[model samples]
Target chain A: MSSDAATDIMDGTHSALRTHGYAELTMQDIADEAGLSKAALHYHFDCKHDLLLAFLDRLLARFRERISDVGGDDAADRLLSLVETVLLPPTDGEPHEFRTALLEIEAQAPYDEAYRSRLERFDEVLTEEVRSILEDGVAEGTFCDDVDPAEAASFVVTYVRGARTENVAVGTALGDSLEAFRGYVERALLAPAATSVTDGGDADDGAGDEVDGE
Target chain B: MSSDAATDIMDGTHSALRTHGYAELTMQDIADEAGLSKAALHYHFDCKHDLLLAFLDRLLARFRERISDVGGDDAADRLLSLVETVLLPPTDGEPHEFRTALLEIEAQAPYDEAYRSRLERFDEVLTEEVRSILEDGVAEGTFCDDVDPAEAASFVVTYVRGARTENVAVGTALGDSLEAFRGYVERALLAPAATSVTDGGDADDGAGDEVDGE
Candidate 1:
């Protein structure tokens, strides 16, 4: 089978997994859900784990595209862009449910080394993107110099994951959650120097809202 | 069974559950682990879910006790105390694994409504505590007036849960992982006023190393 065929099947399985969960997902189920024969399902992917990993691959590909969307000339703009993307509508299709199913799978990942590694790799890529943005921001004076790039990167990614987890668990869209979360991002991400150096200038500056883009 | 006898059996079952996860645990496993017969296990609990709920109840009771330890104090102290308690070692024969196991159960709780309600209530109570503390601080001129106690409170609890999830997935102690987490909490829970006014004056100054106390 062609790669496109394999991708299509993986996408279908990802969607089904999100809606039905891992426990309920089976080879036969994916075959039926994807409109393919059981033998054809086996022809492309070796097993369910392989198919799940493919879904994660797709998720990473899409997120990387968003990371590349940080077209702003400054670090603050880039960081804000990343946050805005996270706060925007979750990608339409199986990807959203794929995330939910992934969270469920994450619960079992401790017992499964392969799943854990996949998650760790995904986190590493995200952290690198965030760290790069922060590093550039520091160089440009757009971000506080004293900020720990590594920790800030982790914080941004972790906060996004937490926000996404809450959304998926509760079925709320990111737009609905943007205002409440903007306050959180302000405290968690903005430079303290930027806030305090100007004598309450930061309070009314609306810097947070501008980046949040709501 | 007599009340005292039932209590003893319940306690034994609870301990056993803590040591083994829900999926790996069976009535026979519980009975054997708890030094009871299959018949005795059935006499006390109808099914695994019943036993699981009882175990969750005991765990919730312990968290309540922990929450009470830092209560009625100043908002910062209360919140910081709660963070320390969560990050510190367990004081009363409570193994860290037990809490990890409880979190593991929380991951599964989404599939079951009754369990999900219990988990939601758990989050609601802690979030409320944080909100009340933030409100008090805002009134007392400690936290900024613009602080949204509800949202801030949610961030605190969610941040802690996310941290705990990391620890469990990595099989690391909270202490081992805490160095990385310090920055995240600072951003998530610290008020802007507190951060700007403090100026690293006392970052860890009086934040005692004692995590849990007898």
Candidate 2:
């Protein structure tokens, strides 16, 4: 399939998932949302599973794109921005419902290698982003020298994954967990200079919300 | 139904889940495992969903009991014991498959209030345990006074929930995460006095493995 056409289909899959959810979503529903006939949809993808895998691929691509845009004056701000992105509640709909649709698909990963492989990309991408941010922070003298970037990155990603999962499964407010993560970054990751610095003021300025962005 | 009968049914549910996994499990399978007629199974629990809720309740009760038994010389050991319990892969069976079944149930928590409510109890129990442990560590001066028990407990629980979910979804090794958590506790949770002490040496004695029992 052409790149543009593939993007269109992935968008359609998102819409159909929003409407019908993971359990009830059908190939025909996806095709309807894509504005393609059933036969045309099948011409590119063999089944709903293949199409959903493609949708996951698209989602991962978009995730990488968004993560790449995460920026601030320093590493701490950038890290919080990434957290904000992950914990972001969808503005247009019930965030819980959307996460529920996602949880259903994730539940299948253990049994389905295709789903598992695709889902693994999300964590890998996030872990890499976090590791790079930590490296940047260390190089800039914003984070502790003793800290291991790779381990801390893994821990952060694990926590992020856990925080989002708990929020969906237990109804912990997204904002609450986001704040919890912010506290962790401040206490565990930041160097004394960064936290207690006279010059670098972004972290302590109380304008964290404004800078973190929507 | 009698208490004995209820326990029997729950045990049967475990066996059935083990044999058939979550998705293919039928009420009849449960009945056969329990050595009950299908009518008896339906009499106590109306459907698989209700039965699963009851099973989760039993599981929570067991979790609390096991947590009560989690003992060590100091707060840190008890804490690691707790981690060991949470990250404990089953001894005799396919641990990943068992986790996958549990993950499948957890996936339903968002849309299913019965499951969500039941599952929420697990996190609540674990978080409370963690908070109490932190409080003990603080009172004993084994941990930093700057730490907030509630927030730290919440963070710990969230990371834990995420770790288990990622393990099932992406096949991340449980043992690897348990070690990562140990590192976090060492660097972030322990007071410097505790870490630098020459007398009380369990944490640093290289016997951490033997002390943190299975």
Candidate 3:
């Protein structure tokens, strides 16, 4: 099958999963949603599990691309941008479909080892990205020397994941909570000199120079 | 049905939900798990939804009781204990079955209005308890006067819920993250005088008197 055809089939599977959930999903439903014959859908994916795996791969790739595109020269800015990308609802104001779908998929993980392993891999990649940022920040003397990069990265990932999960249920913006997290990062993670230079009363003056260097 | 019999039924339902998840759960499975005839199970709860609702009610009650029983004289200690009770895995190292079940139920919330409403009620009750603690702390000058109890309480509840959800998938104890949260509370929420008096090098002397007051 062409890649475009596979994409269309996966998109249909996503819609079906969202509407009917994993347990109730069926091949007929996916085919109807995709506006394709059952044989055409089967040509791309032999079964529901295969289609879901493909969909997950696509989602993870998109996530990696988005994180990479979160552009900023300053390490702190880049970290903050990554946090926003991971946690915030999209600009279109729809309930976060990807996250919602991921939760459903995760529910099946206990029974499906493949799903569980894929999720673990996704988590490791996320934790590594955050750890890399923390390591860079510490090496550059931008973050505190005492901060354990691994633990702090785990903390950030866990907290952001938690916030995203709660937001789905409560329908509330986590903006205030994110602000609180940022404040914690500034106070507890940033080196004193960096904190003073970046967030002090004269931040505008110092920030301009930093931006120019970027 | 006797209250004891009802409790047994709910317990069995909990086990079934944990093992098979909400989508796959059936009344027959719960009946078998409970060692009761199908008719007897039906006598307690007419349908799966009714049984789940009852189970959630029991869970909420137990949560309230646990929070109330968290013995601490100081507001900060009480708050910390409350956080531990809600977020930590059990001492016996069992996976958090109730929270795992909750995640599954929450996934069904979009399609189940009854579950959505019950979860909202649970969230409100939890938020209120946290808010009440913050208010008490502020009145006692233990927490910062500038802290918005409502927003801060919401943040705490949201973060804890998120942590619980993620822990279900990742199999990590939320211990380190909880420590981070406590650190945030001490630094950002406590009044300076209270923080120093409670956590400073001279805390042993000051805390003795506070403990005596209790």
Candidate 4:
């Protein structure tokens, strides 16, 4: 099949998934969304599982494209933008519903090798992008010298992933989470005071005075 | 049913879940593990869903008990213990398999009100403990004065949740993540130098000097 044709099928899959989610989706729904016959879809993909895997790959490609074009003033801005791109929901469908469907798909990773691999690719690519930006930030003096790019990138990506799940599972506001993350980046990441990690290995002195609950 | 009997049933559910996972689990498995007939199991819970919900409730209770007992020298240590309690997988059955089943169940939160409620309780309790610890740390001067306990608690909980998901989905090393988190807490939360947040919202000046990628 032509590349454009395949893209169309992938878009169709996205629409169908948004509507029916993973549990109830079918090949027919994908075909109907693509405006192709079921036989036509079969001609391209053997089964729903195969089609879903390909869809994930295409989604990753789209993500890569988006990242390359996400212009920003500094590496810090770019890193945040890269995170927002994945953390926030797309406007195409009900945010909660789409996340629900995505979570359902993600839950299959441990049991599904294809799904696991695709999801890992997504994580790997995002982590790399964040790590690169972090390195840039450190070099430009926008971030602290001691910042470990790869480690921080992993943390950010993992936090973003969990935030999405929180948005769906517990209705935590994504905007609040994003703002919280931004604040963290500002205080903890951007220009942190050079400090050592010496805790003295000593317990607290029980100065427990002036302790008021927030 | 008696409290001890119910506890036994919950224990059975846990074992059954670990052995068979959420997808393949059945009432029969739970009953067998509990050393009761399926009919006896049904006498307490009408169906598998109800029993599973009860199981989640019991898990949270167990977590609370564990948290209460996890004594630490100071609030910071307490906070770390609190986070670690949930971040690390239980030493039961196969860790990956158990996490997979748990992820599958968490994915059902959107469509399953009972699951969502139970899971929310988990988040609420963890966040509360973290916030309480942050407050104590601040009062004791172990943490920064400007640290917003609630906001930071939310971030920490979200990161921990994501870290657990990463552990299951991508096989991320939980130990490495915990160490990284410790680093973050030390640098960001623990007595950070009193500073202002004045970035001026200005774009990059492009000094473009001494730029070395990490």
Which residue pairs of candidate 4 clash?
A: none
Higher-lDDT candidate of 1 and 4: 4
DockQ of predicted candidate 1: 0.37
Candidate 4 lDDT by residue in tens digits, B113-209 = 8888888998999888889899987887667888999999999989987887887777788877787787677667866331111221221442211
Highest lDDT: give the candidate number. Answer: 2
TM-score, predicted candidate 3 vs. hidden true structure: 0.83
What CA RMSD would you report for each candidate?
5.0, 4.5, 4.2, 10.7
Clashing pairs in 1: none
Q: Which candidate leads the pack in DockQ?
A: 2
TM-scores for every candidate against the unseen true structure? 0.80, 0.88, 0.83, 0.85
Q: How would you encode candidate 3's per-residue C-alpha lDDT over B147-170 as one tens digit per residue?
A: 778877876787787677667776
Q: 1 or 2, which is superior by DockQ?
A: 2
lDDT of each: 0.64, 0.80, 0.71, 0.76
For candidate 1, the per-residue lDDT at A166 reads: 56
Which ten residues in a row are the worst by lDDT in model 3 chain A?
Answer: A203-212
Global lDDT of model 2: 0.80
**Error in Å for residue A135 of model 4:** 0.6
DockQ value for model 4: 0.51
lDDT of 2 at B180: 83
Per-residue error (Å), model 4, residue B87: 1.4
Per-residue lDDT for A1-214 in model 4, tens only? 9987797899899889888888789999999999899999999999999999998887888878776666555666666777776776344434677677778888777778888888899888888888899998788766788889988888888889889888877879888888888867866776532111122122144221111101
